[model samples]
Target: MDWGLVLVLLLMGAFGGFSAGLLGIGGGMILVPFITMIFSARGFAPEVIVHMAIATSLGTILFTSMSSVRAHHLHGAVRWRIVALLSPGILLGSWIGPWIGKQMSSTVLALFFGLFISFSATQMLLGKKPSGGRELPGTVGMFAAGGLIGLLAGLVGAGGGFISIPFMGWCNVKIHNAVATSAALGFPIALAGTLSNIFYGWGVADLPPYSLGFIYLPALAVIATASVLFAPLGARTAHRLPVATLKKVFAVVLYCLAAYMLWKAFH
Candidate 1:
């Protein structure tokens, strides 16, 4: 094991988990690119590197989301009603996401992931609000919305907050509540996605050791360990941080990552 690399992964996890707590995202946006670079440098097959990154990102979220949600719940920010309405469809969509990924060419998947992440970052940077404060939709509509979130999240290994938060905000949900509720929804999205990735990657060729299907357990273990510990800290800091500044900084970083991935895909 590369202890140096392990330390770096720990650092990334800490930051990622903190962001999850602060921003109500699952931290996969931070994890995927770095994980891919690490796997690539370690000589993993190019075809499977992105899969490993995505799978391990989701697996790590299984733990990080729990820690984040607990902190948000204690603050009474989580909307249990929203969670209930979105969960069933989230479960179904998440379960199918990795299956779709595996069927696509790795390069194509990377391209799509890059474009999607860039779009998400652009949304944050623009920080647009809906002109009308419409109420949330009916059960079927919420279910459909949940399905879309889950599918996109599964495809890109995110917590779905990039979509969910914006969606809730458009519906006039308070920002804090939207963040907390998105954190709650992240678990089912990740859990179902992770399980599906594991099953989907079984018996695949060129997979690295210590892997469970598409997931690399060592990365998950190291990242989750640090993320779970620091998440509460991020949650607490969310109350004090200059969020607009932080979001801008984070958006810059995401844009860079997106550009890098897109360059890699086309080059």
Candidate 2:
């Protein structure tokens, strides 16, 4: 429990949580690479560091999403019907993702995370929407969409808002509803993803101290606490401001992260 490390984690948590509330992402997309850096610096097993990063990112998402969703719920923005429809498939897909992911190397996972998040960021920046005549999918369609979202989210340690929001928007859901619903979906994604990480990484060698499989308990504690505290504030800010421009700024940040990960992979 180094004080310096605790401070860094707290700062990371605050940023990630605030971003999650504000942009429907910012949790895992932001946390994964930074957490990877920390774990690598600490000299954990190279094969397992990205796994730990993704798992810990998901762990932080658990609290941050709860906090963000509570704020959205207070504003009557969350579509519980949609959440209910999506959760089952999301959970199933999330559960399967880590098992698949555990076979890949840290470098490969990092590269994937970098590319995927960058694509998500590009889509956010574009801010495209389909025509208004379309509507959200029916039960089966929603489940399939949820499954895909959850699997990608689990593999990359994202909250899935980046993809889900766009998907909903394409289906002619209102931006607010889509964002709110995406926040709701983060819960299942994080929970199932964390469970998968635990199971998939169980009994692997050279896990850091205090790790339950890939989920680092100490990092989870510090990051989750700070992220939760800041999430509501971000939600409030979202209510106050127009987010289109902000997303462009965030997109640039995500691209930088992608570039860094690519650098790390090849260097």
Best-fitting candidate, scored by lDDT: 1
Cα displacement (angstroms), candidate 2, residue 227, comes to 0.5
RMSD of 1: 1.0
Model 2, CA-based lDDT: 0.87
lDDT by residue for model 1 over 6-121, one digit each (tens)?
99999989988999998887899988988888888898998998888999999988999899999989989999999999998899989889999999777988899899989989
For all predicted structures, in order, the TM-scores are 0.98, 0.98
Q: Candidate 1 — which residues are off by over 4 angstroms?
A: none
Model 2, 71-133: lDDT tens digits are 988989888998998898899988888877898888888788888877887897888867778
lDDT of 2 at 234: 79
Candidate 2, residue 86: the lDDT equals 86
lDDT of each: 0.90, 0.87
What's the CA error at residue 111 for candidate 2, in Å?
1.2
**Per-model RMSD to reference:** 1.0, 1.0
